[model samples]
Target: MPYTPRKAYVVGVGMTKFDKPRGERDYPELGLEASVKALIDAGLTYDQVETAAVGYCYGDSTCGQRALYQLGMTGIPIVNVNNNCSTGSSAFAFAANAIQSGQAECALALGFEKMAAGSLGSAWDDRAQPMEGTMTQLFEIEGDKEYEVDDFGPFAARIFGAAGQEYCEKYGATWDHIAAISAKNHKHSVKNPYAQFRISPSSADVAKARKITREVTLPMCSPTSDGGAAAIVCSEEFVKAHKLEDRAIELAGLGIATDSVKLYEDKSRIELAGADMSRRAAQKAYQQAGITAKDVQVIELHDCFAPNELVTYPALGLCAEGEAHKIVENGDNTYGGKWVVNPSGGLESKGHPLGATGIGMIAYMALQLRNEAGDLQVKDVKHALTHNIGLGGSCVVTVLKKAPFYKEGSHCKDRFGYDFAREERRMTQEELDKVRSKHFSDYLPPSVPESKL
Candidate 1:
């Protein structure tokens, strides 16, 4: 027997432009802006929102309440959610689930972050604690020495570097190829009015750019940003009563999973814990949406670092176990690939405002489904997916399907199937030309030659 589908629809979405502002707005102000805009987009008033789920990684106490106060006091319940990088998506999941569970007919999910908090390290890890000894010594080994880079950076670096090198060896991908993915995001971002870094650089430019610190560069990394995004989610009955079926973007699936924070804890775990969670999430999403991976026309993966995409590509089954890099080199992850990834420029260039990113991804995908993405819109986006990974590899995957998918109960089959090599083989020079044409020469490092491919 076939399973009955759970129906939850996203009716309204809103986001502020990501800017590297000279002065930051308070979380309340940012949240207020997003909240008002979301209601406006949904064609509803504050009274219609049965509950509010607000996501923020770093904010003052009572931040959500303070923000809601800016709007007239509504006695409705307000749920505050914090899950590091995945906070936004987690909040969205909660709102959708509440609607599905019959807890509420209409709910709001808001994700807001401000640069006043600083980068992820200073924002979450608290470097000053180690210096003050309030926290354990940086890398002290039972009254011994301190570990230089400590846990997050070194652990992430080892996993990213090792996996990247392995992918390079297995599929003939080069550092140039990896760099190209960053270039692709930046190039696409140049067209996005709301992206923080709206400038493009060639692969050679990124490869030879001066390092800000280690392999990271001003261009290669997303800027610290102050921004917010919000979504209004409601039940199918509410949508129909309000005559909002056209605006309703259905939720097909949601998955959340975690992995060990320590890099060396599980040697056999080739995929991050979040990857496994995302895989399971995808399986459920496919079953619910009645579509396979190939049916997805666009995707937005958690690209906090370029390497995150490398690990995620295979885990999401876009490629084989260790060949995501090849997808980049062949330009299959670009504008007109089998499935376009990160048309919103992704975290690498679009900006990673932590709590805002998950909602931001969904907003962009919804725009594509509605054919309102302008230049970034892929052709015929029937099904789209957003995969966001948080600190220590906490993962959340959400599946979205366009209208008319529910009534028919049709299972969309994979046109390309699970053949990674076939996809790689189809990569052509013409595909590379489109990327090259969008390149901006100013972003290149002085040392690198431009003509060499």
Candidate 2:
């Protein structure tokens, strides 16, 4: 018999301020604090959590053991998940499944990282072998930035550079666009209390800052940071039975997909893969919750880089292919747009702490749904979505709605006033090709023959 999916509700969410990464804070300590706060917010006790899912990347096997030890949370199954940047949502999805399957009434999801004191390069190259030149020279080729370098380090830097150029060329967007994203996030962080960089930057100040390199800039990127975030998930019945305050968000849907690890090796465009994964996830989630993309009033996206958001808009069905840049250029993404994206200030402003990023997205969106977002709140938020991407490019999309769909007489509807849960809008190969072209560009080495995948 097919098992019925459980109706999961977000009962609590919490995170520490995302600031410069500090070694002094241990993983277990940060996780404990976040978990305790989430528990308090959910109106539940630690004893009520029958299971817990912890997400962390770069942390060794014992990291989960160390963190869970802080809360003396033992005996129950505590699964540790590490999916690069999407680790937190991966764990949250697992916990949601557990609650929906009637396995546990209440479960916890915690994400933590101290990457500044820790090593990010370790994730790519454990050896940390320095190139035969200075870090500066190593990043440049004949005084120009190099894009052909494929190993993770230089490759990431070059990708950001290319994206910066692409946005400027295609959309007439400037560094100010990226800065606007960071500035908004910082302002949102101010009220978050748990955000690391709560200091807002003026439009003029952000636009005038010097670039870190040709591609990367101070405001366009997140500083290495240390932080932890946690959440409590439970069944909708569990909340109603307890008569908990109606301050909960329902997990309408969850979806995940993996793209080719060798982006250069794959024939499919990276952007298409991401967008398809998100669309599939949204389809499933919407079908389960009975909502549609038009119904999502708020979004918290993975803005690890500004281009990520620019490209994501079209990929996520927000706009047509090759039109995301144009839409962004017209200020369609600011405070009063058709929909608001990344009100949490994104990774650029909120600071990306690897394991904690996905949870941080959820933490911010939950507040938005509960009308606790303060100045960043959407006027009348009914549905919201959170999207996250991981290493080499894995993607996850989770959707949330204001009310529990299964509640008696609580009709869930999308913008069309039909059920939100439904199949996705299918596309022909031509359409897919167009979207792919927008995401993956042909690499032209001025002097060398282009390497075709």
Candidate 3:
């Protein structure tokens, strides 16, 4: 008999607002805030979590333990993950697997990043770089392009910029189409309170933004950000024990893929951009879910660069090869079209805090599936897909759907006292004080005016 994985569901999800680097909060604070919100959303205490996987890229070893310690040191097994940009989703995959394998009934998947200002670069200078192979592949593909590797804004820009140039040459895509993608995502961000860039820009504005490369513009790339996100994953049995049916969003399918032979073997810049890896992972996820791209109503894909978004359209089967630009030109990639791609503003506008991005995507999808996305909600959403990738590189694609027993408006109204269709407000100081007094007496009281107290 074939092995059947146990079912897992995301009972709760939460995230900090993505912010520019060197923000007020550090990694520990960011992680704890997101974790606490997730726990509250699930109506559970941290003690219920049997295991945890924390993702980060710019931290010391065991950063997971340091961040999670804020939740109380319950001696649960904690796994630290760093798979570049895909770290968060990779951690989530591990957490879900723990439930599916019966190793844990409830698990926490959390990710946070505290990055420095400016474009991303290597942390260690005196070591064999992990991206050595990828760099070699890129140079081979761009042998005489007159592009200086170091002069490019970031290595990522050159990689995706080359891919975009390749795509246009092969598929007749124009630079305008790429700018349109950036513009669309920025427009979507205007409605997302949690996004980093809430101000929408016109396609012309995006196209005219400072160029990162010959083909990539400043607005077309994701900013380096600092933030955190978290999810509560539980087995079906755990969900039932907690009566979480109404709130649970089933993790219908998950697939993770790494660099394939094509990354090094193929001369195609599109392949070098990890499109093949994304394609394979998405195919596996669709297969596992017993669904296809046509079944998906909404998506939150990695738009670290606008060009990658276009390349990924075909990779995820959202469109045919060389036709991704048509989807953008026809307004088929946004609301009132075939699919609402990156309705959360995506990394392009939502911000990519590396570790936080994958789980952030999950949080956004959970909100959409639960009809709690407020102004960013997609209509009649049945199934949602998430694609998160990190160059070096790894990709994770996941499918989510409403739990079979889920009832519309049952969870949010009864538990959270909020209308799912409207914007969720931050908890007032009184509410926070109440929670702190009741469950966290050791915590220092909020510094407030004596009169207010």
Candidate 4:
């Protein structure tokens, strides 16, 4: 008999506000905020979690233990993950696997990052860098070309920037098209309270912004951010036992893929930037979920750079190859078009906090499926997809849908009137008190005016 995987659902999700590195709270505080909020959303407590997977890129060994210690050290098995930018999604995948495999009834996936206040770089120069192969491929492609490497911006900018240049040369894309992509994401961020940069810019403004690399401007790149996000994964039995059908979001399909031979062998710089990995992962996820890109109503893809977003459109099967630029020009990637891509402002505007980004996408998708995204809500959303990538390299694509068993007259509806936004606020104080009282006895709830409540 073929192996059939058990089902898993996301019962709760949350995140701390994304901010510039060293702007505010520590990793422990950020992690605690998101974890507590997720538990509250799920109507669960820390003790109920049987296992956990925590993700981070720059941190000491066992940082997961230190960060999660704020929630309460229940002695659950904690797995540490670091898969570059895809760290958070990798953590989420691990938690989901635990639930699907019957290893845990309830599992937690938490991701946080406290980055340095500049472009990302290697922590150690003593040994071979992980991106050596990718850099070698890039050099091979640029042989005889005299390109000035930007000392101030991230090396990733050049990689994706070159890919954008390649697309323009191979197809008919232009700098204006890439600027439009950036403008769209920035505009989308205006409504997202949790985003790091909420200032929407015009396409012209984006094109004129400080240049980071070849045709890549400042607004085109994701800023280094400090934040955290979390999701609570549970089995069908657990959701039923807790009577959480109304709030549950089914993890319909998840796919993860790494670099293929194409990365080194192909002449396409886009392929080296993990486009093939994204394509493979998306294909697997769509196959597992038995749905096509046409069925997806919303998407939160890794727009680490605007150029990457353009390249990813075709990789995710959103459009035909070599026609991704056409979709942008046709308004098919935004609202009232084919799909609302990156309604959470994406990594470009929402801010990529490395490990937090993947789970953050999950949080956004879950809210959209629950119809609780507030101003960022898309219309009549049925299924949502998320794409998160880490170069050197891995990609994870997940499909989510509203739980089938959920009914109109459920607990969420009866108690909160199905207003997820309001429910999130009303429950925050109560849950904070519950958590603090169990751990920190002297903790006091922040006072809010009755009018706001």
Q: What CA root-mean-square deviation does each model show from the true structure?
A: 13.5, 15.5, 3.0, 3.9
Instruction: Give the per-residue lDDT digits (tens) of candidate 4, residues 1-453.
Output: 987878999988878788898755677767777887788777777878889999999889888878776566566899999999999999999999998888999999999999988788999989999998887778788774676443335678888988888888889889899999999999998888888898999999999999987678999999999999999999999989998887889999999999999998887889988999999999999999999999999999999999999999999999889999999999988889889999888898989999999999999999889887888889999999999999999999999998889644343333333554333333344555454325333432333322332
Cα lDDT, all candidates: 0.67, 0.65, 0.86, 0.86
- TM-score of every model versus the real structure: 0.79, 0.77, 0.93, 0.92
Where model 2 places Cα greater than 4 Å from the true spot, the runs are: 117-119, 123-154, 167-176, 202-208, 260-276, 405-453
Clashes of each: 1, 15, 0, 0
* lDDT string, candidate 1, 133-187, tens digits: 2122222321242423343333333344444544565667676776787788888
lDDT of 2 by residue, 1-453 (tens): 997777788877767666686576666656665665566556566657778888888678857656655444345688999887788888888888899899999888888886755225644555653322223332342234354433333334445545555556666667666666656666655655545576788756666665554555556565667888888898877888866546568887787776533333322223322445555555666677677777888888877766567667766777876677565567667577777877777787777888888887887787777776655678888888888876445677888876654232222222113321121111122221222212222431121111210
By lDDT, the better pick of 2 and 4 is: 4
**Candidate 4 ranges with C-alpha deviation above 4 Å:** 146-153, 409-430, 435-453
Clashing pairs in 1: 139-147
Q: How high a TM-score does candidate 4 get?
A: 0.92
Ranking by lDDT: 3, 4, 1, 2
C-alpha positional error of residue 139 in candidate 2 after TM-score superposition, expressed in Å: 13
Error of 4 at 438 (Å): 6.1
